[model samples]
Target: MNHVAPPGWPEQVRPPDAPEWERTAVGWLLDQCPPEYRGHTVLRRHPVALARLTAWHVEACQAGARRGLAEARTALRDALPMDAVEATIAALLTEQARLEGVRRAAGLVEVALRGRRFPARLPGLGSRHE
Candidate 1:
């Protein structure tokens, strides 16, 4: 059968033959992102928001100085008080945000290395080989 998205929704959002559980799981996953990335998590009420936000943050501090901070973020989710998954989707929208910076930086380094001007190609490799 052809896919019919939710009421008044755009075609792009049409589900991809997904089962209800799959959709629920995906929704749960998306909720974990920061406010901007996914949107507000606890939209129903203030208490729900605070509790969910707290559950999503072990220390409740702003993004940590370095990658180590993700551990805390992770801990918050992983160590839920009662295994509940509720959160906002504002994780990666602003210029200051970086959920995967290290990996991205590593990719940039790889690109730089690939573009480097080597004086001599190695013996078994390349344009400099005689």
Candidate 2:
């Protein structure tokens, strides 16, 4: 049977019921994480574990982005041109948005890895797991 992933699912990952979906999920999760995470054999072998780690990593990245946005002006204005400082702030804002999306996608993948399936729900029906 065909399956449909819910909104916020990463496009790089196949639906949870697809063939070798776990492998794709693992690959996508690892891509979100730092290179050192690839060295963990257990995480490579376990999709759920990798998903959890990816979630944590994404959370840390989001926090870093927030801190950078908060300090961008005060920290860089003195050392850099005003234009450069503004660019830095803009970059941080963009990163914050990107990280938020990644965070949601990672959470969805983690839920799928835990045996929760997101079939296509009816219009106006909201979300359901099976």
Q: TM-scores for all candidates?
A: 0.18, 0.91
Candidate 2, 50-74: lDDT as tens digits: 8998999999999999999888889
Model 1: how far residue 55 lies from native, Å: 18
Candidate 2 weakest ten by summed lDDT: 121-130
- Candidate 1 residue 20 C-alpha distance from true site, Å: 0.7
Q: Which stretches of candidate 2 lie over 4 Å from their true place?
A: 122-130
Give the range where candidate 1 is weakest over 10 consecutive residues by summed lDDT. Answer: 5-14
Q: Which candidate has the top score in TM-score?
A: 2
Segments in model 1 whose C-alpha atoms lie over 4 Å from true places: 1-18, 39-130
Tens-digit lDDT track for model 1 on 11-41? 2222323344223323433344345634554
- Report the CA-based lDDT of candidate 1 relative to the real structure: 0.33
Clashing pairs in 2: none
lDDT of 2: 0.86
